[model samples]
Target: MNSEEQPILSIRNLNRQFGSGCRECGGGSGQLIKNYCLSCGTVYACRDLSFDVFPGEVLGIVGESGSGKSTLMKCLYFDQETTGGEGYISTYKDGNANLFAQSSQEKRYIRNHLMGKVYQNPILGLKMDFSSIGNIAEKLISAGERNAAGMEERGMELLTHVSIPVHRRKEAPRNFSGGMQQRVQIAKALSNNPPILLLDEVTTGLDLSVQASVLDLIKGLQRELGISIILVSHDLGVIRMLADRTMVMLDGKVIEKGLTDQILEDPQAAYTQQLVHSLL
Candidate 1:
């Protein structure tokens, strides 16, 4: 593909602000921001952020909590409305089209048809009360794949792909271990056959061994499905293992961005260097 045809997602000058009142709080101010809780005043979560995700490439975003990685991803995926700037997600065979500027109906079409998301907390993505396989099939049907047999077939395939036992397909996710729950979440995220997958701190609560396995599973899926992915994580090791490119964020801005090896081995920014060093 030509350069113009390469990128599946592009973001430019993206900004998001959260304020308690109508007045916007500038980025310089210190404030605590929560996902659902907007404080008494506004807080800037992202500022002039820009990046791209190429077709079939895995881009890793690394930063401490409150650095705006999650917020940026959320905005790109249209989970949250943007305060300013532009973002595009490729929907047609021709090239990328602006997503942020689209009408609500248009954005909804792209989100449901082309994008899938996995949250840091696995339960947020999977229904704890439903059987693991049931949740996966539900996503398939919701995506408009109406054939019940097809949904069941794909659901079982995904469960096996994640190494969940066939017998456990009928068991509720609440009874599974943390790692198992995450595996089921992955299955659900893949149910829609989305071209882009946004993963937020996917392995956060899993043990080291489980983390390694899950990372391996993601890599394998990427190779097999050829879907573009943006993964946000605090774990440098996860970034090093999964990302071809890495972007480091600090204080609601992108401080460094480059190939994963370049950023890890010879970081130029002080904050980037500090983050790399902290991993050692």
Candidate 2:
């Protein structure tokens, strides 16, 4: 990663909370019960989180369930509204504009053009009834492609790039295996050629062999495309395999961050130490 190069994506003080806070827990002054306010019953799913994704680098976010990793992804993708934050994309308005503050139409444009996301649940990212290639076309169309032949050609190229059989391109993702569905989702996500890709627990729940295959595919694609990616996973093994840099989150806050190798060799945080040791 080139430290001198500008980050492709930068997030500042990103915060997402589920409820209005009370006097005690408002403004992040008071806290109780692991990111929850007992008095107000508010959940601070993400708080004052900030990070950057450099060009062609995979930034991993590792955390357990309720660690706010997934919530952070949702905020970045605009799947959920953020309570407060600023996001800058180098390719968007020359990185001068704050993406979180953009108009809804503008956000949609950014989502369709500047970034792609692969959700852990294929249902969230794919239309089950749509053919696999049709799913790719959907994204391409959203990005302003109008020529049917052009879109189909792009879709076929992407599916083949992701190693999905050309013969199965016409089948719905529902008809494919778990790993195949993910491949289709990947192909669809890449259809628009977005600079940034957000992947959330993509390998979770797959069989061990399938998980390895999916991870291998991701590694290969990242190298082949040189696309920047933000990968969210609870498994440190997954992060270690793909992340150039990593941020560890707990209870809605980042407790550690560094190059993946440094974090593994010398984890400063106790929680991070345990996480690294578990892979031994």
Candidate maximizing TM-score: 2
Clashes of 2: 0
Residue 101, model 1, lDDT: 79
Each prediction's TM-score versus the true structure:
0.89, 0.97
Tens digits of per-residue lDDT for model 1, 185-274: 888888888989999999998899999998899999999999889999999999999999999988688889999999999999998889
Name every residue pair that clashes in candidate 1: 18-43, 19-42, 20-41, 20-42
Off by over 4 Å in 2: 1-4
The CA lDDT of each predicted structure is 0.84, 0.92
Model 2 per-residue lDDT at 220: 96
Clashes (N, CA, C under 3 Å) per candidate: 4, 0
